[model samples]
Target: MISFIWSPGNPLPAGTGGSENYTVGQVRELTRRGVPAQVVTVGLGTDDGRDDFVDIPFLSLPTLAAVGALDGTVVFVNEPHPVPTRRPAFLILHNPPPIREQHRAFAIEGTRDRALIATSRYAASLWSSYLDVDVSTINVVYPFAEPCFAAQARPDNRTGTTRVLFAGRLSPEKGIYTLLETLHIDVIEQDVALTFTATTAGADKPQGKIIERLLREHPAITVVTTRRTPASMAALMTEHDIVVMPSNSQYWHETFGIVSIEAQHSGCRVIASDDGGLPETDCGGVLLIAPDNAETLAWGIRAAIDSGPLSLSARRYAGMRFTVEQSVDTLLTVFAQPQPSPPATIIRQLEELILAPSVEAAHTVRVPTGTTA
Candidate 1:
């Protein structure tokens, strides 16, 4: 049995973000293939937010200690709790390291004795530098859009007005604020016949509520209910001509933009910020734009409107890429292999330096000829 451990206090959300979708997709695929896999949540009893995914198996534990007693390969999603496991463990780094020093220390400590997995190459490098580990030691497992996304057929014709959807969370990090600012531009609102829409994916949070209120008040943007299932989200994408992902680059770097690929799979052109893993998600229908800039975002939308709908061939190419099968195969390979050792601690490095032969000679610095002091 393989158990995917959700972070303590974070209930597994239903299709709200990449990490949640990733966990459920992986478990579903594994179970379909006759492998026993279940999501193990800590502290979130009964209300563990798997309503949309009733078919997926879930285990809710009252404490972290109960997680340590499980017999199987444990894959910790995002947060790695400092608990002893009966089998080898792995931690998937879904987000970048915390900005605070205390949280960084906690993450570093929790990472001990477990293998590291990152969602993208950029994320792997970021975590490697933060954790003081070798970049090669981290494994990359790209997220995928479910088959339903690719199966959705695009409309044969187009309407007079181009439709754009913001499928990400309503938080600032997802660049909802930047999108709001872009819609405020007179040129985008008056000159163009574009109908902008946003979903309430993250509105349960305090910050998201504030953003949601602002979105509802905006004249050009329409606030819609969040789609809780992959099929429903794909259908929503099919209804639009373009999907915008103005992800924030100031304090938050999007590790990977799953919505970009999902939109492309659903036959919608994607306009995303050209930063972090968003660039890597392109399957030929994406338009790269400057992040956090309303002007550039407006230009991107205009460009998409002018360029027209994605060609059937381009959509076909996107469907072929980033399939759930490929992702799960790579994941299984990682699970079967031996995990690399954790990064060496600072004290261990110092001890190694002290024990080295000719330690004083190792510290000697030779000055360049004719180069000063």
Candidate 2:
């Protein structure tokens, strides 16, 4: 039996976050496949535990210890929680963790029957280099778009004003501030009516005061504060001519741009900063912008506005590559693979530090032919 354990704080189904959505979709798809897969969620609003996925009050050590007693269970942990289980387990690395956090995680989780799974090749390479582990040992499993995120109908871009959208976090790293700066250039908003959807309210409201001031000052930019479901978000994407993700590399490089993929899948021409795993998500469905440069971003946005909605081929490529079916199939293949040896046994060579390139040099973007502006 395969069990997916989410954080004690996260909710299921109605939860708006990426990891939450992935878990919900994975469990549902697995159930449909007749796989003995279940989810262990918390704060689900129901105590009945009537669903195939069980609801626990919290993921305390006691709870995990109790779970350890279960037989024939293979666990997949979404968050960094050490399950005190004898059963084999895999840690899903959705994003890159800070060095201290990684150390703490390794200390608690140990290396036995525990293997790492990264969401992108960039992430796998990052972790492998940071931890001095073999990159090949870490499996790269790309996330999938939910059915609701698919393109229903492409928006006609020849209308009066081109509608441009900025979805996801309002943090500095997410480049909301940078995007705001781009508006200072008159060419950016010429025929474009920009929309900023506050999809995530960042960790402890990063740059809250500045973002608030930006939104208040730019009243012409439509602010969609209404909480959106996957279906609604997809519909919202379809309504827009272009979607921009100007992620900055200075803070945390984007691990994977899930929203970028979903936007493209919904036929919105995506313009993204080629930071970390963002290029992987964009694939053949985006216009690449160099990280942290407002001029380049503004240029990309203007180009996208002029270019109009994504071509039919771009939308089709996104749908085929980032579907739930593909993700689920890849996950099943990972599960079928034999258990990996402990990471502790792997030698960490000091020579790597002298040999490997600098961090900035490592995360540099090289846009592919079809995906570039």
Candidate 3:
């Protein structure tokens, strides 16, 4: 039987963060299909080892990696651990490792764990370049909505001038500080009620500073720093006409930008930097912003706000392209096949796995689409 071992991350059970939704949804889908899938979680909580997916937290990730090596037919939905676990595994690349990282070898070791399943084509290219290898079978599989964006409309545009919203990490790579600098210079919030949301408290460098200045300077603007909820995200998006993501690094680039997709699904126009996989959705969503430039981001957000509300067609396009069903279907195609060759062999350019399988295949699947948070 095909098996999977996923790593635990923040923002689950609440249907909030992108990675949380992706990992949870993927586990749920495979387990529903009778595949033996279990997640290697960290923080202790009620273990939900039911159906196709099981969340077990005891296996120290480092030790689990060694055990996973012998499973021979397991899939992973996260990074590589200290040792190669389970052969024929899938390593989901979220982003390139941070620059100036001291553990470059560890990161590369992690990359060598999967057969290479990139969430976005951009991610694949970035890894290849990062590792200086031509690891090409690395395919892209997008994520689905969290079921919140699919709900009824809840607009909060108050005065109709246009609601502008910026939400995501408060890190430098997210460009929130740059965004604030531009807003400071432009005085854009004079009429429009701008709102921002992010995880605050013990946040890195610029986020805390940006939020402080934003709240102090602009009373008209509301800044919220807290754990996010699906209802909150939906309320934010539906009420606002525009959503902005100013991701700075190409590695930091959005791998299938679920937030952007979900926002559009809620009928909010998206303004995102084109550097990362955010451009890969092919959802006909997002007004692409050049990376790291305050002028371009400000301009992009301004354009989204000034433009008319998203068309029904736009929402449908995003919802259709990034749905959970489509993502899992692509993943299942690999899981149902014969055992994938060892990463060691593949890394050496061996042709065994590249060749055709002995058996013939006759089935295909078409997954459904929907809106999400």
Candidate 4:
């Protein structure tokens, strides 16, 4: 038996982001192959926001201690809580390492003795350097789009006005602000006949409310309800001609843009930033631009409009690229392999060497060249 551990107090979302979708897809695929797998949440009870995914199995434990006591292969998602397990455990690094020194210290401690899995090669390199571990010790398990995305069909005839959708969460890191700023430019507003749309995903957060308000007030952008299912999101993608992902590169680097592949699989062209793992998400229909720049994003949209719709051959290639089966196969291979021992002593020594005199100085401290915060 294998169990994926969701962090305590954090309810599993329906289909709002890549990590949630990846977890669900992994469990479902594992079950289909007769592997007993389940998502174990702590303290969420029945209120876990998994109403949209009733088909997926879930188990609730009273405490994190109980989760650590489970007799199975345990895989911790995102945050690696320090706990003793019956078997060797694994921690999947969904987000990049925290910027704060205290948080990084906790992460370093939690990662000891547990195998590490990153969602992309870029993420693997970033975490390996941050944790002072060998890059080969970290395994990559790329996230996949559901079958519904590849099955979505496009319209036979193209419209004169390009329909662009920002399908990511309403967060600043996802580059919704960049797209909004680009739309306000005189040149783009005057020259392009494009209709913009954004989803309400992630709008529940405090910061998201501010962005959501801006999106609703924008004259050219239409705000729509977030699609809670893969099939619904695929349908939404098929209706649009293009999708934009201007992930912020200054602070938050996109580990991997799942929306990029989904858009391509749905036969829509994608315009994403060039930094981080965004460039790796190309399935033959991605146009990369300078991250966090409105002018560059505007020009990228113009380029996509000029290129016309995605080709039939490109769409076919996308269909074969990132599938649930491929992702699960790679994950199974990693599970079967022996876990590598990361140099925890070296990690502690590096932390001590970099310890700063003040909190302000510590925040500014970063790893050496070829690695990032």
Index of the highest-lDDT prediction: 1
Put down candidate 2 lDDT per residue, 205-227, tens digits, no spaces: 54755675567668556666534
**Which of the two, 3 or 4, has more TM-score?**
4
Q: Which candidate number has the best TM-score?
A: 1
Q: Compared with the true structure, what per-residue lDDT tens digits does model 1 show for residues 1-373?
A: 8899997887888757999999999999999999999999889897887676798999999999898899989999998687888987888989988888879778988887788899899999998888888899999999999999999876654567889999999888999988988987776978657899999999988998999999898888898999999999999999999999999999899988889999999999999999988998999999999999999999999999889889889899999999899999999999998877665444577788998897355566889999996
Give Cα distance to truth, residue 119, candidate 3, Å.
0.8
Off by over 4 Å in 2: 10-15, 42-62, 71-78, 99-113, 155-159, 189-217, 345-373
To one decimal, what is the Cα RMSD in angstroms of model 3 from the true structure? 14.3
Stronger candidate by lDDT (3 vs 4): 4
Off by more than 4 A, model 3: 1-16, 32-36, 42-73, 82-87, 156-158, 187-189, 192-220, 225-232, 338-343, 346-373
How many clashing residue pairs appear in each of the predictions shown? 0, 0, 8, 0
For candidate 1, what is the total of clashing residue pairs? 0
TM-score between model 3 and native: 0.75
**Candidate 3 on 99-165: residue-level lDDT in tens?**
6678787777766645767777777787778766675656667677656675647554557466666
Lowest summed-lDDT stretch of 10 residues in model 3?
51-60
lDDT of 1 at 207: 91
Using TM-score as the measure, name the better of candidate 1 and candidate 4.
1
Find the number of clashing residue pairs for candidate 3: 8
Between candidates 1 and 4, the one scoring higher on lDDT is 1
